[model samples]
Target: MSVDPEIFAKVKEALIDALGVDDDEVTEEATMVGDLGAESIDFLDIVFKLEKSFDITIPREELFPDDILTNADYIADGKLTADGLAQLKERMQFVDLTKFEADPQVQNFGNLLTVRDLCSYVATKKA
Candidate 1:
């Protein structure tokens, strides 16, 4: 689905205001943690800011559910099982899972979440 540029701008501005990231750093493909330097703890603040800025509620689990790495249904022997990977890919469709699909590492799935993913999620909520 095509996202509205206005929505993208609002989402980007919210992320910048919340995360203190430079305009150059908040690209569509920028990984939240890897490229934007977002820590795990920063997600809560980010979500809050986005919600407040957009006047919409973002479901926590929909964005970044916890315990996937520890859940047996999602991980096996330090890696994501085939079923687990499928589930993750379905849940995080906004993310580019090419690398993770090639390697199938549960540990790295979280790393696939990018700034564009956040924008897409928010845009969907608004829709």
Candidate 2:
């Protein structure tokens, strides 16, 4: 699912407006936390901006699920269960969980999400 250039631009604009980042920094491969320096709270602002700009409602849980560590259905003891991984993969299609699949750590999962992921999600919502 290739993102339309126009939608990509809109997503970038929303990110820039919400996170106050330079245009060059908000590339498709840039992770919101690692590359673009987005804090946890910044996600709420970004989602709000995207919803208004695109005129689409994005369910918060679909984009950022509750902490898996605390969710019993997603974890067991200290490891991610198969059902949990499947659910995560479904919700986070934009993320490359190949490496994480081998050792699914709760803390690193959120960082795996990239700017392209958010853009793709918004594109889907608009469609």
Candidate 3:
């Protein structure tokens, strides 16, 4: 799905304010953790900023999905099991999981979310 330009602008602004990143660095493909230097602790501020900017409530599970990551039923051998990947797909339709699906390593999941994904999520929430 194409990202809404207005949503993208808001998301980019929120990411910049929360993460202290440059405007040029907040590209659609930039991973939240890898490219934008977002840590686990930064997510709270990011979510708060997004909610305030968009006037929508964002539940923690909708963005983080920690339950699936930490669940024994969804993980095995440092990677997500097939069922786990399926669950992630179901939960994070706003995210493009193709790259993460290729590896499915729990460690790599931190880098899965992109600016574009955040914009899509906001779009979904606003809808």
Candidate 4:
């Protein structure tokens, strides 16, 4: 599915507002769970914000009840790049932390990186 250019801007804005992170730090490869270190509730909140911003129906399973993606899936998706499609696919699978220093709230997300969170967050994105 094709996403809008503004979707990135909106989603990135939501992320920064909700999570107190920098927009530049939120690449498509950045999973809400792993890279941003979002909690289950934080993720639920992110899902809500993302849904509202995108005006898309992100299923509950996509956010809470699922398999999502795996570690190998991360390699498969590649990392988030400037290309929206690639970044979306990558963000669907994993979160890149190369820009974490710019966002201190990112440090607060460290506890949310369970393997279950990792896979589920990715799986949700693909969904």
Which stretches of candidate 2 lie above 4 Å from their native place?
67-69
lDDT preference between candidates 1 and 2, better one: 2
Worst 10-residue stretch by lDDT in candidate 3? 1-10
For each candidate, give its TM-score against the true structure: 0.86, 0.89, 0.96, 0.45
10-127: candidate 1 lDDT, tens digit per residue: 8788778867989888878788888877887788888898889889997787788565556888777778878777777777666667787788766676687877778888877887
lDDT of 3: 0.92
Output the TM-score of candidate 3. Answer: 0.96
RMSD of each: 1.8, 1.8, 0.9, 11.2
Instruction: Write down the worst ten-residue block by lDDT for model 4.
Output: 65-74
Give all candidates' CA lDDT scores. 0.78, 0.83, 0.92, 0.49
**Residue 6 lDDT (model 3):** 91
On the 0 to 100 scale, the lDDT of residue 40 in model 2 is: 79
By lDDT, the candidates rank as: 3, 2, 1, 4
Residue-level lDDT tens digits of model 4 in 1-110: 23344555666676777777776677765766656656667667766777776566676653342222222332223322234324333444443333432332323334
Residues 27-85, model 3: lDDT tens digits: 99999999999998899999999889989999999999999999999898999999999
Best by lDDT: 3
The parts of candidate 4 lying over 4 Å away from their true place are: 1-3, 67-127
lDDT at residue 61 of model 3 (Cα atoms): 96
Order the candidates by TM-score, highest first — what do you get? 3, 2, 1, 4
